[model samples]
Target chain A: MERKWNKSSLMGWQFVALPSALILLFSFYPMFQSLLLSFQSGKGTVYHYVGIDNYIRLFSDPMFKQAVFNTLLYLIVQVPIMLLLGLVIAHLLNNPKLRFKGFYRTAIFLPCVTSLVSYAVLFKSIFAVDGILNKMLLSMHVIQEPIAWLMDPIWARVVIIAAITWRWTGYNMIFYLSAMQNIDPSIYEAASIDGASKTRQFFSITVPMLKPIILFTAIISTNGTLQLFDEVVNITKGGPGNATMTISQYIYNLSFVYTPNFGYAATVSYAIVVMVAVLALFQLKLGGEKR
Target chain B: MKKLTTMVVHLFLIVASVISLFPFVWMLMGMTNSSSEILKGKFSFGSMLMENIHKLLDMTSLGAAFWNSAIIAIIGTVGTLLLSSMAGYGFEIYHSKSKSRLFGLLMLSMMMPFAAVMIPLFRMFSGMGLLNTPTAVILPTITTAFMIFFFLQNTKSFPRELLQAGRVDGLSEWRLFTRIYMPTMKPTYAAAAIITFMNYWNSFLWPLIALQTQDKKTLPLVVSSLASSYNPDYGIIMVAIVITTLPSVLIFFLLQKQFVQGMLGSVK
Candidate 1:
């Protein structure tokens, strides 16, 4: 039995060895290296240790401040609206009596599957000065002239928020819909028998039951928004005077587009990590994990 | 009142679906129109589809970009599924205290933002003389922690009785894994394939940094440069967009059932 146990344990290690080694090299090792890099200061490959200076520089750096503000703006405005829309849509579609269920679900889920570059191209054209959105507003007599959506600072942020919400709402909805399946249907039946309306039951039962999944989506969206890059890079390029620049974009610009101050870039990346970690912890605290 | 409420629900769903699908319809129309027509917000199909395709092919190396993306995505997806699934199975089935601790550490690795590690990873690759290579793009992502977690979650429902039975039948551990465990996990494999393929194909940032040469660029990089040109051509871009978007959509439509099931398994 001792020999058999040893054999199986050896097999277990063999199964795990390759993947664990890869992760250690690619993920864990690089992580430590970046942490070390964050303490050094230089452009490109040249560097010398400057402990905590990068962190200190972050406080007075106007561009970093603007990027953080813009990222926070998206997190505060977009995530809630998207989650709410997703939950409502999921609740409505969860109705067994709803018509064209598959069609509606598939259509709504389609956006998440689109390549980031494709959708960004589509959105840029749609919101261009002479684009369809302005044309539609003009046709409806809502505006006398075209709105330069991507050129104006405020509207540029609005377009970024709208784009993120459009792409991700259905993704969060899938989580809600799946979690809804686990709720005992007879509870809703019982609620209705006790003279509760649909709205009442949704608020009291469904919301409470789906709280954990909601928390999951919230944390995920928080992390996603903090690391916002693709849309801003593709759509606005943090243009119209850095109006829509995100921290992730700033990091990219630092390393690749500019003189490649890799240490400062690593510093900015750590800021994002800290922000996401704090927010995630807060969310878990509030949501009260069942586990 | 019941009739009114039902009407309201239908109206909401219809409006949302229209909004969701409008970009796709517009993209298809844009592909067929001239650049000026697209800029002018023309909604109908024009006679320029073939012309746009020809121009796109002429202007850029779309064929090469597509080939690079395909090779990277295929190799990355297959390698990720095989290795990560192995670790996941070993961790879950061969339960040990130390292994569980290691698994927890792996989960923490997933939470670290890729940007934080990008500079160091780039330095490491450059040190190894792997810069501007597709292997740099493929190697770091080949054994993603999230994929391992996904497989671990799905493996929870896998029956242990089958393993015991295979053992009794004189099957070796490796043989049982190859001949039985793998074949039985078809749905999970399909789901992982679709997700991994889409990820590798659509990946922009890491590839953008890793690959420096024009010939080495992927489709997204080419499309990005084209769009940023001082005199951007909407027609040609729409063609490129369609090409970039089609494969993932096709895979999604084909494997959607298993995809959703796999997602459901994860969140549960």
Candidate 2:
């Protein structure tokens, strides 16, 4: 059966043209609009074309600097820890002989599905000055006093990082677990017959095989952490001193929390864009070659 | 020694699951306790579920907000599935050098953090008098490039011979899509639906900025407001959280089969 390539047939122009145009409008237009918005400066009703003042001001703004620091802190500390834990857990669970694997998988994966409000509320309670964590620590004689996890600046950041890692590690695990399923079990059997220990086989075979997925999750997780807002806003409110403030939260505050500085807020938003683009380019260059 | 190691791993997993499941258990326990009791770390179940429910029902427009969320999620998911899958299918099926270049550009959009776009998005929505509508919340995300990219990646596994056969069958372009493409991609559609529904359902920032009134607020926004009260009642807030989370969990469980399979297909 010969497939016709006619105007009205399955390979027609309208088929591709409509979807392509939709992408151009919905995906491209708002982005271009944002690019334009970043260049202008104004209050609610007043407006002016400030060529690069907003971008220039970002370098000097103390709060913006703090937010940049906090975001990067999370990127460095939280991303590696979560990915590593996820990798370990996925390796353990990939054992076909492992007991109650389904239960373990669901239990970890369950956290990601928990509603943001529910988990945020739960985390706030668990990390409160007199919350379960402190209670447990005192009961176990780990500490004689209750720690102000959310009130102290350094501790507050710790709690935020811990909360993010806890919530997302399972999500990353799902990616790894799914990727692991594609591996032939015979390979593991082969390794065992050749006298490779479990840990050795994991490091040698599993890590290298799952490198693409690891990189993919790393990029996605980086994007997620870079846009970190809901957790900070709900859990910390960027507060006690701006210890846990993120760029997204700062952008939110600029746009809605304070007197609305739409133009300036757009500029801060673009800073994140530039950072993500550079980091993504670097990661792709670093990881893409190996794949 | 082998038994000891296995025992340790099992113990570790058991402890981890308990820790993981503690909050959910607490949420339920909190729903059953009073505000003061919850704040005081009362871990056991109480008899206040009905009271908490009553208080939450009276404090907010629970029915309207839930309805609004449902409508938005349902519509947004449907729109996302159709438009994104169309683009995804187009990009994968009609693969060309230019289309591939365009695909790379679309992937770049996925990397741009939403924080970078929120304010400009707000201004754009406000300019169109869309600040307080479901349309405002759903329109911008309806054709998200991330969703498009996801579908495109999954479409890589879609058999080309099926399309060739459909063409041989003298089916029109639309018929090939509606007849051949749609049915074969049920797993993909299911996964996309679950993800998009949750995205639209639990979406907080955009809806918070866009929707101004009490009636238009989503479950998350309403819960946020509830939790923010100067003297927030933990029991009541827990109830709100449970309500907000239930639908997504239920949707995920309902669609888990396809969700995992679709994702597996994409990675391979």
What lDDT tens digits, residue by residue, belong to model 2 across residues A1-291? Answer: 233333233343444456556556655666677777778877876778899888899999999999999999999999999999899888888778889989998888778777666577678877867766787788899999998888899998898898888788888888898889898989988999999998899988999899999998888888888999888878878887999999999998988889888888888888888888888888888897876
Across B1-268, the per-residue lDDT of candidate 2 in tens digits comes to 9999889888878876887778878888888998887766777899999999999999999989999999999999998899888878877776666666776776666666777666667777888898899999998788877777778887788897997899788987678888988899887898888878878898988898899999998888888888777888888888888898888677667777765554343555
Candidate 1 per-residue lDDT over residues B1-268, each given as its tens digit? 9999999998999999999999999999999998888887888999999999999999998999999999999999999999989998888877677888888888888778888888888999999999998899999989888888888888898987998899999998888788888999888888888888888999998998999998999999888888889989999999999999999788779888876765454787
Q: Write the per-residue lDDT of candidate 1 for residues A118-184, one digit (tens) a residue.
A: 7987899989898889988999999999999999999999999988888998888899999998999
Off by over 4 Å in 2: A1-13, A16-19, A288-291, B96-98, B159-169, B262-265
Extract clashing residue pairs from model 2. Answer: none
Q: Give the range where candidate 1 chain A is weakest over 10 consecutive residues by summed lDDT.
A: A5-14
lDDT of each: 0.89, 0.82
Candidate 1's DockQ: 0.75
lDDT for model 1, on a 0 to 1 scale?
0.89
